[model samples]
Target: MKYLGIDFGIKRVGLAVSDETGKMVFPLKTIHRSTRENLFLELLNIVEQKGIEAIVLGLPLRPDGEKSLTCRQAENFMHSLGRRTSLPIYTVNEAYTSLEAEEILSGKGIRGKKQKESLDQAAAMIILESFLECIPYERGLK
Candidate 1:
């Protein structure tokens, strides 16, 4: 099944998608957030177009696994999103996703403007890839 992963941030929202086989994950696009309603509408359109069967949201948590004000904000966003779609929504601990993305880009020689532009989407890709890796274990746990 295809999946959509969201790296929701205050300024930009990053999106990533998995192939129909659910094995390969890739950065899709970054949505510049001007308004909350518009962000939701954009997500709805992408979900429809991508045939996303599920959503994995990157829940930004503290190193100690505590939810901060930002995390609470994201929770509210997720709840609002739940009302819009029947697809299963899941959250993954996304503590250092952005840092990892930065490191990955730097290793590949991406810097400055290019790195900044691609960072969020790369983080979303990491979030989605992490979620996909846990699927088998998650299913077994079920």
Candidate 2:
């Protein structure tokens, strides 16, 4: 089952998609927040065009595993999003995905504005990669 991974923010949401085999993930794009309808419409287009089977979201929890304001906001977004689709929604802990993503970009010599543009999508890919590594294959989670 192919999956769409999301790193959702108020101003921007990062997107990633698993290959058809669900074994590899790649960064898709970042969507600037306009309205909820527009956001969902874009996602729906991706879902239809890409044959997405599920969605995995990043929950921006604190390093200590406590729920921060951002975490709460993510939680709310998840619940609100649940109403828009029947496909399962799963969340992974996204404590330092952004930092890791930045490091990845630096290692690859991607800098300045390019790094800023790709950061969120890279984070979504990291989140998806982590989830793919952790879950059992028989469950079709990856």
lDDT of 2: 0.91
TM-score (C-alpha, index-matched) for candidate 1: 0.96
Question: What would the per-residue lDDT of candidate 2 be over residues 43-135, giving only the tens digit for each residue?
Answer: 989988999999999998887889989889888888887898888999999988989999999999999999999999999999998888877
Model 2: how far is 104 from its true place, Å? 0.0
Give TM per candidate.
Answer: 0.96, 0.93
Number of the top candidate by lDDT?
Answer: 1
lDDT per residue for candidate 1 within 59-141, as digits (tens), equals: 99998889988788889999999999999999998889999999999999999999989998999999999999998897995
Give the Cα lDDT of each candidate: 0.93, 0.91
Instruction: List residue ranges in candidate 1 displaced over 4 A.
Output: none
